[model samples]
Structures are given as structure tokens and as C-alpha cells.
Target: MKTDSQLQQDVMAELKWEPSVHAAQIGVEVKDGVVTLAGEVSSYTEKLNAERAAQRVQGVKALAVDMTIKLSQLGKRTDADIAGSARNILSWTSSLPTDAVKVLVEGGWLTLSGDVEWQFQRQDAADSVRYLLGVIGVSNQIAIKPSLSATVVKSDIEAALKRRAMADAKTIAVEVKGADVTLTGTVHSWAERDLATRSAWGSAGVRNVVDKMNLV
Candidate 1:
């Protein structure tokens, strides 16, 4: 087991190692196995990158982001510009369909709404605009179009878990209610838990994934 200080050092090293994050501006605090990141980043993408970098460290039981986006003068733009950029980017993204997502920008935050046939498309819409100059945050309300049965979703998740060798199918209880999936199980590590959640989300027509996985 890693001590709190050791975990903190590891997370800091990871932050420095990540190219997109400015490690010097970030302050890392760890208690038990939980990590808290506090600082200012140049962009919302950097903030997201910092969070992901910290979570990559082993022994991270939970993560709390206290970081804020402090965009540069050149990085800041009007809400209208942000909306226009978001729309243009989403349109160019080959993975997303045309006019599939509607963008609304208030202040610098971008909100997306509409429907897509797959979870990946919904996520792609957000990712397409994550690097926008003035985007402070994104709320993806683009829902998935449900087409598969609950039983099929459950089976698909189980199959994916088995293929990945993350855990036993029987150990992770997958419950599908409508387009929502609730995962209940014990995962050996944070990475495994993340994989399990992704497996649930990867299923066709899954709208929401509720991760109730306990780490052991």
C-alpha cells in the first residue's frame, strides 16, 4: 500500500509528465487515497487533462477537482464566437451527424442538446468542442436513441467484461432498466472499475450508466 505522501508525489509526477497540463500551476493534496487538485489552468481542456492525469495514478480512491479555468487574453472569446466555433467543429467531426446536436452558449459554458444513435456520438460531440478557446465547461444533454432491449444490453456488458478479462461476469451484477444500466460489483482497481463502466456504456442504446462498484 502507498502512503499518502507517496501517492501525492506520484500524482504530481504524473501531472508533470502529462504534456497538456501545466504541473507547476497545480497543487496536489492527498489524504488516505483521495486526491484533490487545486490550481488555475489555461483552458478547460487543460483542466480536464489535469483531472485525468491525477486519476491515472495508482492508489487514487477518489478525485476532487478544485481547479479553475483562467484563460489568457488571447484565449477568451465572446459567447457568440464560442457558439459558432462549437457548431463548426461538431459539423466537421465525421463521427457526428449533421445538425444532430444543438449548441447553446451562456457566458463561456457550452451546452449541447439533441439525439444520437450511439453513446460514442454523444461523447464525440462534446470532445469535438472541448478545445474551443472560450469553453469553460460542457453539459452534454444529447441523448442516445434507444434501440436494443434491456436483456441485450446486460448480455453485451457481460460479454465485454469477459473479453477484457477485467472480472468474472457473475461477480459484476448488471441490471438494465429501460435504457439505464446499474452496475453493482467489486472491482480490484480503479482502472477495472472504469473499464466496467465503459463496458456498460458501450452497449447499444444505453442512455445512462450508474456505477455502484466497490473497490477492493
Candidate 2:
């Protein structure tokens, strides 16, 4: 196991390697394999990229982000402009229905609300505005429209996991309650955990995914 100091260094290195983040402005602190990032970035997108980079480090078990977005002069715009841009961008995104999302901007933070048939469409709405200039943050409040029966959701998710050759397919338990899914299992790495969660979310009508997976 890596020491806390070693893990901190690894996370810092990972952050620096990511081209989108300005690593020097960020502070890395690790305790018991959990990393906390504190700093300021030019935009919300860079803050997200920094967090993702730190999570990619091997020794990071959990992450806490205390970063803030300090927009540059060129990145500053009125909330009205941000809202208009968000709408335009979402409308242009092929994966999302043009009118499926409603945009609300408050102090450069964008809040998206609406209903979509799939999780990916909701996510696409957020991604469409994440990189826009003057965007300090994004809140995706888009809801997923339920479509399939609970039994069908469970069977479809299990079949998909088996097809993907997930190592713990047999061990992982899928419990469907209404539109929610709870995954219980032990995986060897974060990648496997992500795979299991993705499989659950891919099921039709899945509104919430509760991950109770343990890393071995």
C-alpha cells in the first residue's frame, strides 16, 4: 500500500499530466488514501478535469474537492448571456432533444431541469454547457423518464453485464426497487466498480443507482 505522502505526490503528478488543468494552483492533501483538492481554476470544466485526474491515480480511494472557479476577465459574462449560450449549445447537441431541457443561470452557475428518456440525454445536456465561457458550475437536475418494468430492468442489466464479461458478474447482486437499482458486490479496482454502475444505469427506466460496491 502506498503511504499518504506517496499518494499525494501521485495525485499531484496526475493533475499536472492532465492538459486541461492548471496543477500549480491546486493543493493536494491525502489522509488514509483519501485525497482532498483545494484550489482555484479559471473555469468549472478545469475543476472537473482536475478532480477526474486525481481520481485516476491508483492509490486514491476517495476524493474531496474544495476548489472554486475564479473566472478570468475574458471568461466573465452576464448570466443572461450564459443562459442563452447554454440553450443554443444544448439545442445544437444531437444527443439531446432541443426542448427537453430548461436552463436556469444564477451567478454563472447553470442549473438544468427537464425530463429525458435516457440518462445519457440528461448527461448530454449538462456536457453541452460545461465548457461554455463564464460557466462557474453546472447542476444537472434533469430527470429520467421511466419506461421498462422492474423485472425487465433487472434481467436486461444482468444480461448486459454478462455480455461485457465483468469479472464479478456472478458475484454482483442487482436489486431493482421501482426505478432505482442497488448494486452490491466487491470489485478489484475502480474500473470494475464503474463498469457495474454503468451497467445498472444503462437499464431502461433506471432513475437512481446506489453503489454499495467494495474494493478488494
How high is each candidate's TM-score? 0.95, 0.96
Looking at model 1, residue 161 earns an lDDT score of 88
User: lDDT value for candidate 1?
Assistant: 0.90
**Model 1, span 47-132: residue lDDT tens:** 99999998888889899999989889999999999999898888999998889999999989999999998898998898899888
Residue 77, candidate 1: C-alpha displacement in angstroms: 0.7
lDDT of 2 by residue, 19-51 (tens): 999999999999998899998888888998998
Candidate 2: where is the Cα deviation over 4 Å? none
- Residue 91 error, candidate 2, Å: 1.2
Report the Cα lDDT for residue 191, model 1: 80
- Ten-residue segment with the worst summed lDDT in candidate 1? 164-173
